[model samples]
Target: MILPCFLFTSLFMVKLSQRAWNNVIIVSMLALIMLFNLSSNFLNDDSDAPAFSTLIPQGLLISTIEFSNAKVERVGQGWRIESKLSVSKDLQGLLDVWQSVEVSPFEENLQWGDSQPKVTVWFIGQAEPIEYYFLILADKTLVKLGQQTYQLVNVNYQTLIPTE
Candidate 1:
């Protein structure tokens, strides 16, 4: 729509005055270039999205965290967040965020089934003894849990829990 309009307007201007044709063409070309550049910039900006992280004191007791050997399974309708960890007191207030939370002498894997329609787990926050899972959408929109929002930052993935 816009391309055609630009071309038409430039052509009409050129038809009105041969002397002004070159100037109109230049202006029209510049306008089209600017429009393309702006649109591409906006599209690229949304590609990776964002995740959040915060620093806390060491030795703050947190449960163990791990991802399933399987890639994050988007089964049924939503993506699953599966992991095993030791239960900790710090997680008491955040239990609602997990699809499943369990403790066992042996590794007990848990899953947050069907997270697709609403959220995508993008980042996981971890400290000396605590671990957290951050979920977001493909567009980098932070997934909200309780009252907190997540954002992505540069961090060590080996130390932090994995996102599929």
Candidate 2:
């Protein structure tokens, strides 16, 4: 429908000898394309967040263990997360462990210095419900026992790791 309207208006403009109208049509098309691209980027991010969140298990105790400083970047991915945790205090004698994971770019055209994105972390243990938390930093932070859920918001391009 839009294409037909544009074509008809273009033809009418040519007949009326309105070159400026043609330029306006071209600019309008460009602007429409740009808006579509921007909206698509945001929609894609919003859609993916839920799928990732579903990967976490429910009903288990959870908490964030660590976080890092936000690192902004111009190319290749946006942020990463490093986590260290103690799952259960009763399950003592086990070594304290840390996991590092990379966070993909929220938007394909996301340039450097854009608003920071959030990172969600989930921990699922044997016979245990999933735990998660949010963090603002991108580096490692100490996590206590019995709290297993962690969520991190506004994580930049920094890497997160477990300290203990």
lDDT tens readout by residue for model 2, 2-72: 99698767766565446777786788799899999999988778553533322222343223322333221
lDDT of 1: 0.39
Clashes of each: 12, 28
Which digits, one per residue and each the tens of the lDDT, describe model 1 over residues 1-164? Answer: 99888878767655456657777678879988999999999878854532222322223222333344322433343344344533232223332223222211212233333452232232234422323334433533232333343433333222233332
How far is 64's C-alpha from truth in model 2 (Å)?
A: 18
lDDT of each: 0.39, 0.36
Model 2: CA > 4 A from native: 1-7, 10-18, 42-148, 151-164
Q: Could you tell me which 10 consecutive residues in candidate 1 have the lowest summed lDDT?
A: 99-108
